[model samples]
Target: MSNSPSRSVIVTGASGGIGRAVAERLAADGMSVLVHYAGNPATAEEVVAGITASGGTATSFGGDVADETAMANLFEHATTIFGGIDVVVNAAGIMPLAPVATMDLETFDRVQRTNVRGTFVVSQLAARSVRAGGAIINFSTSVTRLQLPTYGAYAMSKGAVEALTLILARELRGKDVTVNVVAPGPTATPLFFEGKPQEVIDRIAGANPMERLGTPQDIAETTAFLAGPARWVNGQVIYTNGGAA
Candidate 1:
């Protein structure tokens, strides 16, 4: 592995939940983090502040991961601020659950644009910009295997992400870059529990084998492993769920 001292990482959707947790965790591990948020600059700033306050290095930037130009600018900013990127965690995604019959085409398209296209835009930039021994960690969900009825659109988007991971791993065969995906099951993010009744949330939690919903920190630990010491592990979608899938 490349023993570069500056170890910089870029994390998308860093304003909340899994993204926020991953950014903080990576920074704590002594990696300079670039926290990327699509909106909510205040939340992004808060994440940066928390990391810096804890004696970790972090900076926040805003850009839509779905837009190639915006993603390009994000990469440029990272290079300017931290010299270069050594890892990228693509954590930007949305899960709007609606049965296929009732799901609006526009909503479906939005999900695809952000989850699939956004991941592609960022992963490609990571591939081109990150140093030789860098790692690219993409987000996926265990819903693809669970095959829930209302999650068709969301699962489709993540399915594309899984395919992208496999192909990117092959494409970067000799460059020493590792591309992998982390699939979490029923994480307890605001996005997951938003607007749900207490009983509904309880049932969802009970459904998991662990009898509790996953925390952002749980997912972050997996990301940190993939991003850092687990260099031998590559081209695999490691499911970090507590056997829920």
Candidate 2:
């Protein structure tokens, strides 16, 4: 087997939450990581610091995941820093909850732009750049399956992600690169807890057979598998929701 240090990953939105966890996990497994952040450079830097402190190779880059030029530059920058790219994880996204009837076009467009367009832009770059046997892991949501109220727009964006992931896997035929999606359900991130009442949180948690919210580490474990050893699992969505379905 090739040495683990030879592999490198670009994880968008790596400042915190699932992204940070994924970056850290990949680094711990001996892959170099590019911790991409959209807005908070400090947090992204902190993630890099933590990785380095653990004797893991990591660096932080700032850019909008939806911009084609910016993302291309990010891919190039990561290559320059790490020698080559083996995994691309589209973990950067936004979630705004509102019923379809009450949702304004601005909010709808914003979510679609970041979640759908961003994934497309990143996947396009990854398709063009990933090495043979590399992996492209996109983020989706279990809400796409649960179909809860106020998640219409968010679910719509993730639905598009699922479509993109499967099709891209086929497009990369013969390249030995795998494209897949990781759909998390009600993860215990700061953004998930905001504005949610304890009763509401508990109810959602109980809906899952595990009876608890998923940690960022839980989602990271799934990502680590797809990025490294799960070659046969391509063009599919792995719902890491503790049996919420």
Candidate 3:
């Protein structure tokens, strides 16, 4: 990692939603960004274009987050482009809601592959390569605490992610790199709304004290804090939900 004047960050799943918001917010904060997408180059390019139009520095990359070689290549590309990476946000995750008993093995395994293995791969690279003062932000979910039905597989995957992130934080001691998990509640994104009925959404939105679902910007603010000044907040899962759990 180079000691550049401005920081550089890699935001996986940054083509849309919370990841996209994080990438944009960090770029607005003056860090060069590498927007990463799993299967969507066009959306990633849109994100990059938006950042560049706003006078921020950004580019796009595509890779399978769960694939070790692909993610390793991603890290190398970021280093090659930005001189060095200072922050890595493991925001790439997939949530497939299903009862553990009824869910097939394929779905459950897919969830783990993307949410757990994906985070591990990116985090491993970040742990070794991120600058001394860098940070690693991993995504979890409040469903782990809520224990909601139909969320068993998703919650289990996120649970693994949380554990991995916390342990990584301790492992990175003396390296000045902070590792933390951001567990969000029911946020209004395509991912959250997918296949969920309107009544279910309304009920969830009203369950929180805020009486509304969390927006992508709400999550992004927390991420920005972690990636920048919240150096002491390590090894903890900060829930970004509106008091939902």
Candidate 4:
């Protein structure tokens, strides 16, 4: 393994969930990491602290992923501080559920702005900033395939993400940059567990042949693979869903 500390990465939404796990995993892999948070500075700091305590290099950054200016600045800062950026994981997002029949325009817009626009903005910046041999990993959801009720807007946003991922990979043709998306199914993050009853959760878990919920670490390992050794896996949507969907 060419685990080089000179390699640096930016992981957005690193304050919690899969983002945090990616940050930690990259740090352990000898990559300096920038832990980014949308609004939770404290959680971001905690991640940074933990990495540094374990002798891994990491720092915290804050920005709204959907804000072009903010994202641009975040990229500039990462490049400036780390000498150059080798990877970017756009893991920041928001998910709100409402049936399409009764879904408010405001809620739909909110989902689009954050999930779709945020991904577009981050991917654009990453395309321009990442060095050759780098990877740009974006987040999509397996829900896009599962097509669960009340997830119409979310699925639509991720469908767009799938489009962006494949197109971006082709566009980066000679740059040695791989663009891909990770679509997780029924992860056990606080976000996934928020309001669902145990019975509901159990049913969802059983839908997958694995018969269990996925952990953030499960997704993080894939991010590590793509960011480092999986150079040939370009423009692919690797489903880290334990065979769900």
**Considering only N, C-alpha and C atoms within 3 Å, which residue pairs clash in candidate 2?**
none
**lDDT (10s digit) by residue, model 2, range 1-245:** 34288899999989999999999999999999999999999999999999999999998998999999999999999989988899999999999888999999999999999999999999999999999989999999999999899999999999999999999999999999999999999999987887889999999999998899999999999999999989899999999999998
| Model 3, runs deviating above 4 Å | 1-5
Candidate 3 lDDT tens digits, 92-176: 9998888778999999999999998899899999999998889999999998998889999899899999999999999988999
The TM-score of candidate 2 is 0.98
Q: Candidate 3: lDDT over CA atoms? A: 0.92
Clash-forming residue pairs, model 1 = none
lDDT of 1 by residue, 1-245 (tens): 43234899999999999999999989888899999999899999999999999988898999889999999998999999899999999999988889999999999999999999999999989999988788999999998898977899999999999999989999998998899999998898999998779998898788877899899999999999999888899999999878885
Candidate-wise lDDT, in order = 0.92, 0.94, 0.92, 0.93
Clash tally, candidates in order = 0, 0, 0, 0
TM-score of each: 0.97, 0.98, 0.97, 0.98
- Candidate 1 Cα deviation (angstroms), residue 238: 0.9
- In model 1, what lDDT does residue 64 have? 89
In lDDT terms, which candidate is top?
Answer: 2
Instruction: Let me know the TM-score candidate 4 reaches against the reference structure.
Output: 0.98
The residue ranges of model 4 lying beyond 4 angstroms of the native Cα positions read: none
